[model samples]
Target: MPRAKRFYIPGCVWHITHRCHKKEFLLKFARDRNRWLDLLFRAKQKYGLEVLNYIVTSNHIHLLVSDNGNRDTIPKSMQLIAGQTAQEYNIRKKRRGAYWEDRYHATAIQVDTHLASCLIYIDMNMVRTGVVSHPSEWRWSGYNEIQNPKKRYAILNYRRLMELLGCESLDALKEVHGQWIEDSLKKGKPAREKKWSRGIAVGSREYIENIQTKLGVKAIHRKIHESKDSSELREDQSPYTAIFGTENERLRQENTYRWGLF
Candidate 1:
């Protein structure tokens, strides 16, 4: 089947995730993880990609970045990072095959509450997976760098992050960011559901509809009844999901848990 079209609106934050081929632990080692981070750092400098948050897990990676509306910036940055990482890994292992499963999945996030929620989600990924009790303990994530004022990782754009959070100062941004993560931890980790990734876009009803119209997708309404009254579903479902709903059922049936080393 043809791939679904990806819509990139200038000045929008995107939550991107990509998995290793066959779900293998390609990034299980610390050196490999560090290499990925180094490559990302270079990509940021070269492409002007503004990375707000990120986490590198054993077999996958989550990156929250904002494009300056260049259209090619995000794609080119991903290409440089992913390609270099894969090539280095292949040379080290002396093997030839695809490193990534497919193209990275990018979901446009609403810049307000949804953006904050997505940032927290990325920060708590290691905690959610039971790999680390706290985000600070995870060296492969942005949590530590963001929390420690002295530690600086050039990959993260602190000014832009603060701007998004509506904070007036770096101290305020750090305090609020730390509190956000702590509060999320207190609430317990959320289910690693596909809502963040599977949707065409994530935000309020109006936000999704706006993007849908921009993408020229036909808007349709489905009815739901509670008791004797009928209500209309206002949210726009993913175009991919709407057309391939059955695939999700198959994925659910095959669900299994696998534990890995930190």
Candidate 2:
């Protein structure tokens, strides 16, 4: 089959995820998590990327991010980010070879509805794993950032997140976010489905269709590779986006200086 077109457009949001080899608790320790986060931050600074939301589970990670329009550096920046993370993991564990199972999995998010669904899926991941009763109870995710807006974390883009969520005021943003989490918690843990792979078993048909359009294909295929167990495959690796970059240069320009912000 022919390769599909890439979906790395300026201002287009994507839900990106990656998992460890064999679902082996790659991020079981605090240092492991911090190391990954540090590398991600450096990538953000170097590539002009913006993270809308993220969650780092023991074996996998979920990220909602958008191209900062830096077409020249997005790929290079991501390579550095993933490469450094893997290197650190191997060095700390005294092991060699792959850390994450495969290249990252990502779906371009084009609509507000899709954005809402993605956030819901990410926030409820811990609950689905039986680790927490509610999303707000999870400390390593954007749900906590929603709960405490005063606290700023490099991994989350709260202001833009609120704008995407249709927030006109701080109170409104908090109220809507809190309510969304409560709703997801009330739904209880997500049940695993056999046919669907990665993330919640179901999402809006519209969202899926939109992604298919962006991918320039009617269907998305997963090419699963083996070097691990069943749970490990599901836990640490996702056959997501292999490529993402923008073609527009105007969007790549830094507006901070123009606004007298820097």
Candidate 3:
């Protein structure tokens, strides 16, 4: 079956997720996590990848970045980071085979509330998994860096993030970010699982439809019936329900290489 072409709209913020092969704890140790972060730093230097937020969990990773309208930058950065991380990990562990389960899932995020929601989602991933009580407790995530500017890690581009969030100063951005995260926690809004990881793009209805039109794909229809499973859809008003068709359906019907994620 042909793969779906990845949508790379310039100036869009993307939430990317990639899991370890077989969902194994490939990055179980702190050193391995640091290694991945090192490679990400290198990718930033080499390709100018504007990383906004990130969290390196034991089995998977989530990254928020702005494409700046460059189609090749994200793919190239991912290739370099994932390829080097896997190669070094294999050499050290004396293991061989696929390290990543599949190509990373990239979902375009609207610049408004959706971006903020996605950031909170990524930040609170560890908390949702019972790994930490708060996102600040996770050392490998952007929460600590954003909350404490003296972390001395140049992973997140604070100025750019603030710009995107429409904040004139770092202090203002941090205030709003902290308040939002606190409110979400108090309301128990952090999802145990995210539908953003499963969809093509997430934003306002108009924004998603525009992307569909630009990609020359059929518009996604809302699910007529909701499933009872927790892993299924939720009542969130966000336009995250618009999936870019299933991979098998795309392969059979479009016969094109632009298949969505597995």
Candidate 4:
């Protein structure tokens, strides 16, 4: 099947994840994690994106970011970043072939609630996975930036989240952050499914409806009737390969005589 186009628009936040092929342990050491972080920083600087939260697990990575680039450009930027990281990793480890799956998966966070949920989801990923007891214990994320005043990572902007939460003081922001963590502990139960545990935004109906409206479409469900002779419905050839070939051939014929008319 042809890959679907990635959706990336300005002012949009995405919960993005990419796993190693076959879920292998790609990031087995500190150097591996550091390389991933370096790639993320370079990507942010080059693409003019804000990395809200991120976690580099042993096999996969999660990113919550906002891009200032034009909507269509974000996917290209992400592809470039992922490709760069995968190339470096493969080369350094003396590996071959593709490092990641076909593409990174992204889910649009539509509302503030969804964003909040996604943020909590990302921060608590390590906690839910038994990698750490608390989010602050996870060394790969911005939790250190949140809890430590002197510590700083250029990609993390705690003030931005404070502003988003409408908190005027850092103290207030810290309090809010604490409360959020507490509430999340109560509400954000351990995710049984791996995908959801890896920062997938479980959105509400309203959020989904908004997505449909933004995409300019309505999703309809259809029931598949069972048939014994399923082979009859199968296509021997893909039509996508020839969708524009006829027009291209006509244009080629039209141009051939012009070049040879002399």
Kindly indicate the candidate among 1 and 2 with the higher TM-score: 1
Please tell me which predicted candidate would have the highest lDDT against the true structure.
3
Displacement of the residue 142 alpha carbon in candidate 3, Å: 0.7
Could you list the CA RMSD of all candidates, in the order they appear? Answer: 9.4, 9.4, 6.4, 10.3
**Native-referenced Cα lDDT, model 2:** 0.60
Q: Global CA lDDT of candidate 1, please?
A: 0.74
Query: lDDT of model 2 at residue 159?
Result: 64
* lDDT by candidate, in order shown: 0.74, 0.60, 0.76, 0.60
**What is the per-residue lDDT of model 4 for residues 1-262, given as tens digits with 9 covering 90 to 100?**
5533332333556678888888888777888788788777776677666676788888888887764444544465567667887888888879898788667776556446556666777888888888777788878775655655434447655556665656787778677767788877776556743333322233554544444343321111211122231110111123334333444334423211111000
Stretches of model 4 off by over 4 angstroms after superposition: 149-153, 186-189, 192-202, 217-262
Candidate 1: the clashing residue pairs are none
Listed in order, each prediction's TM-score against the native is: 0.82, 0.71, 0.82, 0.73
Q: What is the per-residue lDDT of model 1 for residues 1-262, given as tens digits with 9 covering 90 to 100?
A: 4554354555568889989999999999999999999999998889898999999999999999976757788888889988999999999999899999887878777888778888888988988889888899998887776887544456788888888879888789889889998888888865684656655567766666665454433223322212221111233444545643443333322221111111
lDDT at residue 168 of model 3 (Cα atoms): 88
